[model samples]
Target: LFGKKYIVGGNFEYETELGNIKDGKVLKLQGLSQKHRIETTKMENMLSYNIFASLNLTEDFSLLGSYTSTKSKEYDSDSLTIGGKYKFNSVGDVVNTYFDNLSGNKNDRWRGTVNILLEAEDDSDRTYFDMDGNPYPGDYAASTLYVPKLTMSLNDLKSKWSYYFEGYYKDNEMFQGLKTNEAEQHATRVHLEARWNDTFSRGRYGINIAYRNETSEKPQNYGKKGFREVKRGVHQIRLTPNFIYNLGNGFALNGSFTNIYEYNYIGDKEGQGDFIMENQGGIDYSGLMPRAFMRLNLFREDTWHDHNNATERKRLTQIRPTFRYFFGNGAYTQLEARFPIYNGGYSNETRTQIIKSENYETRYGIKYIQPLAPGLTGTIGVTLLTIKAKNKATG
Candidate 1:
């Protein structure tokens, strides 16, 4: 005897912007010279809300819930969230005596979830860097955020097998003058699975295990003054046995093999010591290391139809390729390059570079679009970046 359902939704948004700039070394007689110019304009607004619910405490017991709220007063933010879920069922064994199947059901299952979040901000007219170092454009400044979460799952246990677990927590705050910034974070995850149907020949197989843990704190004008803190962990094991032979002409073959382990911890002690005398001219503090990677995927599908219009129109395609190689004990290898440009959709131009002893780095981009007719579209983009520092160590 049970039944219930409900849902609600909301949304509203608006944004505007304008800008102009000119100053090429004071216009040294260029085909077009605007001497020196600058213009700017902006406006913004946003609102959001959401709610949902479900319940059927019988014929297998069940319950669910959800909630979300958001508001953006021109960048001064706000946020919220709520969540819930529960389910239980099992049968076939006479003597199962209710109570959600003696608290252990077959075709079996158990689930749980919880969530909470809050945020706040006040920019204070902006412009900062005081305490005598210069640049003091003020409006005060304020910020806040907090989050919490939890999850649990166990499905089809007796008939085969499955398990999952998750956890999370966070807190952040910021304020200008007398300087005050704070941070905290925590994480946990676990999973397990096992399956072997088709008894002996027809085919189906599986085995998997995973684990992760994380911790962090040290934010408030960052590093140099935040008395840093960080910790990390990861472990994984996977073995898959898969097979399918329908042979009706649509061929198939699948494979899987994974083994991974990782660990990291960094508390920037003088930028992790001696990356050129503790980042001499500055930047490039390699701390926290331990890495590994191995991933692969392969898939194929085909279909076509036009045999006398039997209401059949079929066309299917799929192609996937991936490869990764990295090993333990602080491995290092990386390359990045970027170039960008786009207008309206928003992007003007952007470039980035990082040559860590030539491990690798490359990037490129360009974008610009603004066509309000025949397919309406708008875009703008711009970006540029480079890194490799530590040069100025003279006793």
Candidate 2:
């Protein structure tokens, strides 16, 4: 890292020409990647980073090729990328981009090097579990990782895709990827995501799809028998399509639809793989101004699960409202509230659903924010009221 501000990178290239062809060349290849982080203000309270592959040529210029990943804690973003980059004056400005990008998509073009990366590093992490109200102490974290990220931008049509796979067959789960034929002894996790965005002059809209996979297999040499593929390989997929549009004066419309699918494997092949399907939707409205703004959102979700191959159904609805007003000297007061209008989780499951429930909870809170020092902001929040109400019926 270059002084905690910018990430440094280098490339090596060798180019040659073909003999008996007109305007044609055959070039051999190598590989390079870049990761950088830009420091933001304390008020932002975000962790932002970017990673991308390199396609270098000539003295100090190259067009961007493929594979880019960017993440931020605040704001729903798909991906931020550019056409090409040029380096002339300084080294820290390697990924520096000009505002006048060749691509017509002119939404979030950054000046100077703005990129990042996140690497999960650990010796070994463990977790504790409970079964039948009895504390069971045997859980493991993912120790190996192989992530391949990809992003593409053509004018206003953009996409970000990534895959994080933990381990393969016969490799050690507690170490890096190497050619081996041994028993892997620990549990693992997988994460994959794909998102697309279309940002124009008025507002932005996008669709996000994510997937998660996990395994809970036992150790290679544990329990009454040896390790097997008994309780392992579970999957979950979430698809969300969202939009926010401007309404000219002081109001905007926003909403999202979330669809989910799940699968799992248990004991031989007797257990089901596709066990659950969920659908959720939320609508939001915002009243905006220069110094103050407020937002209100309503949501509804319908989901189900499985146990012993007997499926059940569930449904819920929620409402959330928030308001914030800014003071003269960067001080602000905000209020937020959330309550469930309806919640039902039981509808004929003999294995796991013993009681049908509805009406879960209600919450409300308020907070004040003030600037304390150069790099600090003070916040005081209080939960004014909360109501927990549940109605149960016969199973």
Candidate 3:
């Protein structure tokens, strides 16, 4: 992007990774497991910077901003994003706002991840491989994040239906002291959309919805409230439908469907327990040339997990199909397929004890492009795969 009237830009980056390790003496293949220490060493360094700005502030208002910085020796971060926009001339409208701030230095010991809520334990699924047993490498904390957003849209409407809305907020924190392993979280989000069209005819349709909510608290014994504050909540909902069609010599078709629902409340205000459900669909096709394409997909998922006091149920199914072709000098061809199924247990099992698994896969590929000499080009490819499975156990 370039400037025109107060539009600036900047970018800089540096990266490095070097490795050296030798003292080897480990090898014992066959069914795995038999290594007596193979050493490794890696050192990484990174630096980054970015800057941006835009303004035209009067003619219906506008301003945009950006700043980003990153440094790593294991993490250091910075970010700032700003946005604003407003315009309305009768029925045509637009509104937008955004804010962001992020800061970091994270690495809290005992196998990191902010100390995993001080090595969480509520009824043991066991984890905590060392500290008193020796190898406990972690500790470097200080983190922060905040985000805000809002959006509204309905532009140049001459009516065929149009609408959009959005809202968002997020906050996260970690400091590793204030009671012990301090952590915090909060989230909120919402989105909506609607559409219908034939602007010039090719068809279009759309509907979208989204919602999210989250709350978390830590410190319930990391120092006895020094920051392991166990409190959790999460909720999510989503629905989507989209379509597009244009079937004329250049062909085109598109489709989308999605449904997702989730709910979880643990400890701190428990009720409504656990839940999850998901569904997905996809379809796509494009003319036979100029780089052909095809796609099909379906997915389903269900969960009802709730620990120790038992409640378990899980189901998953997935299917995917893909095809691609292109040839002119840059030859290409591809085919792909996948299927998956798994059904789970508990919910007072039955249905033959409810546990099943199935899987199948296929893949194909071909590529060839050779015209070496004058602008040179060369490529070669080969790929093939096949897989099948049923009821688990495989070798």
Q: In each prediction, how many residue pairs overlap at the backbone (N, C-alpha, C within less than 3 A)?
A: 45, 5, 11
Candidate 2, superposed: residue stretches over 4 Å from native: 1-185, 218-230, 266-270, 273-289, 307-309, 328-331, 343-355, 384-395
lDDT of 2 by residue, 123-195 (tens): 2232222323332333323344332222222221123432222222222342475234334444455556666
Preferred candidate (TM-score higher): 1 or 3: 3
What does candidate 1's lDDT look like per residue over 158-262, in tens digits? 455555566565444322222244234333344444444343343344545555454544322332243334444434343444443322222223343343333
Ranking of models by lDDT = 3, 2, 1
| Candidate 1 least-lDDT 10 residues | 273-282
Give the winner by TM-score: 2 or 3. Answer: 2
Please give each candidate's TM-score.
Answer: 0.23, 0.50, 0.23
- The most accurate candidate by lDDT is 3
lDDT of 3 by residue, 255-367 (tens): 66666566666555465555566655566676655687887777666666655445656666667677777766555566665565442211322233444444455556555
